[model samples]
Target: MQTYPTGVAAKATGTPLTTLQRYLQRSHITLQPCDVPSRGCGENRGYSQRRIIQIALTTELARLGIGPSRAAKAAFEFSDKGNTGRPVGELYPLGQTLLVGLPDGKSVVINIPPDKSISDVLSNDSAAFICDCGYVVAKVLSNLSKS
Candidate 1:
């Protein structure tokens, strides 16, 4: 498998170099092979395809208003669960909502209610975010099966 250096990985994942550096430093999560080395360190950093995907996921989490630390954690957790070297398709983005399938063969769409806007949800302290996308796991499994 080809490995991408820091600049290339950042471009591939649509993540800022500084933000990627921060995650590499603060998050103890081990990306597959070759992650950014510590600041001022001379070690060369590389990113596997899997690590780039993880960075993409982390960027999405950041867009969803998740803090960098938490985003890094969630992205790594998702990566760990899949444990595949395959890259996720570029077509998918973390949309406003998701349709998830349950273990019981049930599917549900999670999103803000029709009456609520993102601003409304953000402004209201009583409002909460909801996400129920188990199909994401299914997709990951499907991709791994192809390998």
Candidate 2:
């Protein structure tokens, strides 16, 4: 598992460096290795593959008008602990149209069966943000490969 610095991670995740920095500063994004003085601050400021996925998720959240802090927290939770019984990272590179319900400024990812249609997923939601996990991961993986 290769680790990328902030710049490379931002590029890989399709997030602007400044935006990523802001997320980090706001504690929306927490460095995996933990950027602490004991571990050589600069040396530990790295993002792993999972982190890239988390960042990409944040980008998708932002597209849905989610604020930086909320988006970061939601993305990190979805990517790290998952929302649909599994981490969103597990769906990486797969063409899964994740139906993320956005109600009252809350981000909740609903589990949609493979046989279900978008209409089925949105049957009860007031607002939904579909995250094309495949597309997002493709962009990130493509950018990462370029490194």
- TM-score of every prediction relative to native: 0.50, 0.76
After TM-score superposition, the amount by which residue 114's alpha carbon in candidate 1 deviates from its true location, in angstroms, is 22
Best by TM-score: 2
Q: What tens digits encode model 2's per-residue C-alpha lDDT throughout 43-143?
A: 64667787888888887779778776777766665566654355545662223536364766566545566776767767867764556566676788899
Candidate 1 per-residue C-alpha lDDT over 36-67 given as tens digits, one digit per residue, 9 for 90 to 100: 44356776676665566667666765776766
| Root mean square deviation (Cα) for candidate 2 | 3.2
Which stretch of 10 consecutive residues in model 1 shows the poorest summed lDDT?
Answer: 83-92
lDDT of each: 0.51, 0.68
Output the number of the lDDT-best candidate: 2
Error of 2 at 133 (Å): 2.1
Candidate 1 lDDT at 50 equals: 57
